[model samples]
Target: MPIGDRDLDGIIDVENSRLLSTYRKFGVVAVKGKGSYLWDAGGRRFLDFMGGYGVAIVGHSRREVIDAIEDQAERLIICHNTLYNPTRAKFLEELFKVVPRNMSAAYMANSGAEAIEAAIKIAVKATGRSLFVAAKGSYHGKTIGALSLTWGPRYKEHFSKLLLDVHFVEYGDPKSLEDAPLEDAAAIFLEPVQGEAGVRIPTREFMTSAERRCRKAGCLLVIDEIQSGLGRTGRMWAHEHWGISPDVMTIGKGIAGGIPMGVTVVSSDYADVLRLGEHTSTFGGNPLASAAAAAVLRVIEEEDLARNAERMGHRFSRGLEGLEGRFRIPREHRGLGLMAALDMRLRIQEVIPRMISNGLISTYSGLRTLRFLPPLIVDEDDIDTSISILDTTFGAIEREKRSM
Candidate 1:
């Protein structure tokens, strides 16, 4: 509103009046962010546990990211896919080092959904199959190929007619996958940590067995690390902890330090499957996005955010467990590293608005899980502050129930 310098009062009012109501936005209009805090138009500060939906792994408005964006903006922004871009090439070269050895090449996309599409294309092309097998309660993305693999009845009921054939077996069970006749299947998609399905952590045995079975059956293995990637879970990539490397992997959300970027890395064997003109994106490998992504990776590496996340995550998990003793409503606390979720008896209908009113925000994996995804750079004091806010809010709800 005022040269993007903390004046959102007038901007939000005008936006509400004219823009479409797709998202149920919070009342406060955030103007700026740095480290793990954000300020609204009224200069109200919020300890950003959300982190742009787990996008700001290295923290908000990081100097490195800002510098990269500025440098790229001055140089060149967008160009067609027909020509090569310097930043994009550099980003890919850096990306290849962190990925599994099997994954040799990558395709850049503008968002997670596009990466999902690319993964789907690679998997299908590799195996020459049309059917996909996924787990129930897994969220790949909102695009057609991704949504096809998603297994929520409520979300898919309206779009049933528009979906494709995706067989979903129970999550955290490898027998279902092993027993299946998968000769005609393209890939078996799994999210190492089921972010939307309540941060469900599966056993390493389950994942390893699933990978073995998929490989044995000649079906490509695709892991969606969109929400769980880039040190959110104490690892460069979430799949690394499982000891199973996917033939193809999708990464986004935190790839570019809150800037927009998505990636689909594939093994060299399957990488060449996608023809020159088969799939392409206009903004997929833009200098601005790739430059930001490179900066994000550099920050995560230089700061050793992965190790920090592991240490802080254990501390936070223990703290949460202590709180659970007092509250006793949430059924479980689970996740890896900084990515954690609580299985709450309180449904989303009641808990969401309550948390928001208390000057805090949380996420729901299903109707039950209250997800806690603090930034990787979030300090111990901020963790304490967030827990205090939640404890106060939960106590109020308990008091109201007692009165009722």
Candidate 2:
């Protein structure tokens, strides 16, 4: 169906009836997006701070990404991994230039979950161990292999019988790593900044400790940068903030500039563990996504979005922090480079819709934290506008509490 012809109600009804009821609806039928804004089916413009869960790294409908996609699609879209394609080769070349120097090999997949799954296979094959270590409150992905390492039982309780052996350690606590059993572990999965855990940032000591422990146990350090990489957190990779390098790294959610693409990058030492036909994906690194991703890399470097994210993120965080002095709602504000969040005193379910009604959109971490992932291209005006909307909504909610 044509996007313009579909009304909000029709689209909503079709999705609610036809799709699996696993996702929580945001109540906005977004039809178009450009730069830092989204347009609903009713032509309402919204400041998109959620950025499609950090997929729109370069922002929605970016000309460079769109042009790349169009140009590649006109010639070819899909070429299996068995064949060497120029676009795919170009993407790998672009990827290596930005990644850690040791990361010389990559396995392309379709989503962060696929990337995590591939990392799991690579770790096991490379280390020849059955156990793994992950942190508490960590969220890797929902696939079987990735879920085994994820925290929270709600996602894996039903599939407990199928999961692998994984030990959960306390995040940001070096003592926990020292106490955990890691002698026979295949890998230790860590996210530089825990996004789903309300933008949790670990201390440099903890990150270095994990790296040390991985070396001590003869296991690989697999950093999952799916949400934190690609200049989302000021740095190209969040782990760089701690000055620690991982043996294997999984990245997605903007690698292809909104196209579905995942990558499991490995160091040169373990590059050849996955032999021919041991692992492969049909649409991984296809011509269309490869071209788009290559363009995304160029845009990030050429435009210096990382610097923008740093400057804008500090401004946005300060604005949010200032609200704590005037409002009785948000308890605290914490974040790093465009990935800001407010741990609210009230339920975020009531707050998100109000902000949406006021032409702003954000996401939530857990139940009380309002997470903001504005695009790397966001300007001071956009940040201020979002802050104003949040301030207004938070004030209104506080007033209602006073009345009650």
Candidate that would win on TM-score:
2
Please, what is the TM-score per model? 0.94, 0.98
lDDT (10s digit) by residue, model 1, range 1-404: 24454546567767788799766666667777888888777776777777788887888899999999999999999877788888988888878877878888888898998999998888878777888889988988877777898877776777878776788877988777766666778898899898888788888988898788887889988899999888888988888898997888999898988778889988877878998789988888889989999988888888889988898898888877877988956677886899998787788667767777666666667667788777899778877887787788778888888999
- Cα deviation at 197, candidate 1, in Å, is 0.4
Off by more than 4 A, model 1: 1-17
TM-score of 1: 0.94
Question: Per-residue lDDT for 1-404 in model 2, tens only?
Answer: 65343477778888899999988899899889999999988789999999998988899999999999999999999999888899999999999999999898999999999999999999899988989999999999998999999997888979999999999999999999998787889999999999888999999999999999889889999999999999989999999999998999999999999999999999999999999999989999899999999999999999899889999999998998888888988899999998888998888888899999998998889999998888899999999999899899988888888899
Task: Output the number of the lDDT-best candidate.
Answer: 2
lDDT of 1: 0.83
Candidate 1 C-alpha error for residue 299, in Å? 0.5
